[model samples]
Target: MAGSRKIELTEALALGSEWRHMCFAILYAPDPRMLFGRIPLRYAVLMEMRFDGRLGFPGGFVNSQKRTLEDGLNRELLTKLGEAASAFSVERTEYRNSHAEDTTHVVAHFYAKRLTLEQLEAVEAGAPKAKDHGLEVLGLVRVPLYTLRDGVGGLPAFLENSFIGAAREVLLEALRDLELVEPGSVLNFKRHSFRQPSLNS
Candidate 1:
């Protein structure tokens, strides 16, 4: 989905109870204040460059027969974050939203979790040993919160990066709901307008 220029969405289906469940998390930690650093001490979200080269949160299909959503999420966290999984508490996981996914008709369940700076460091430290690293995940990526918070009235560089399925919108929604970003900023981003060049030369 990332390599291609065209963006695609799953085909719409009738509202029904039957839907394949999937889950992902927008995990973040408060940025540590730096005396001198390019990336200021600000909150950041952990993301993954998936096998398909598309940016997305760390998670996978929910085996409803084997485990519940929470259980599945914990499993995914362990897989993606490795030993770093123990560094942070679950805090609270909310049912962010449910959206249909491409082709698979996957009903994606997204969650947002907060982590301590210590936990963030642990996650970074454990990245080299992440079980899914290089296999399902090409690499890790961080989306700085300041960019989104101040990225209104135009497309942010972060938004330019391709996201899997409905991840971009979902990420934005999570940020807005978490109070990390303003609703106006999100709204402005959605209504991004481009100026046309003058034809007369």
Candidate 2:
């Protein structure tokens, strides 16, 4: 289980205080639906299947003294995406959220970045040769953000997919913050998910 809330730090801890930590990159490209900005538009999120068979973004442990967060992100990308890392230009990376994981007791930091469609395609094309493929990573998947604009419901169904750690929650919060999906819809989806029986049920 993972904490449902964000990590709250009263005072900054020493650099080495954290025993376990991780970073994830949420990369997105403009959706095809954005044709001349005339149709409903949404960004497409890159997700992947972890070795544990759960879904999550790409990225890994941070070597704070050795590299910046973006550098760490790029390193992980290279590991999972191979030489495709050279194709993408990281527009900017924003802090997404933080979660204190229960299983490993690791603090996870998430960052969102925008990439050109061509770059994303390059990464996808190079995935088969990625060093971590089939070991640390099982395969790549995409979260369809275009459905988020649906009035009846779409975000919840997307969330229904099994996501590792606090990924689902992090995505929900991030999507809300990005204004890609309405908060009310997410709230409704939360309520809907809560009413359902757990998978173990």
lDDT of 2: 0.69
Best by TM-score: 2
Q: 37-77, model 2: which lDDT tens digit per residue?
A: 75454666788999987889888886755766567777888
**TM-score to native of every candidate shown:** 0.75, 0.78
Off by over 4 Å in 1: 1-18, 32-41, 89-93, 147-155, 193-201
Question: Which runs in model 2 stand beyond 4 Å of their true positions?
Answer: 8-18, 34-41, 89-93, 146-154, 194-201
Could you give candidate 1's per-residue lDDT for residues 48-81 as a string of tens digits?
8999878898888767557677678778878887
In candidate 2, list every pair of residues with a backbone clash.
Answer: none
Per-candidate Cα lDDT values, in order, are: 0.67, 0.69
lDDT of 2 at 99: 70
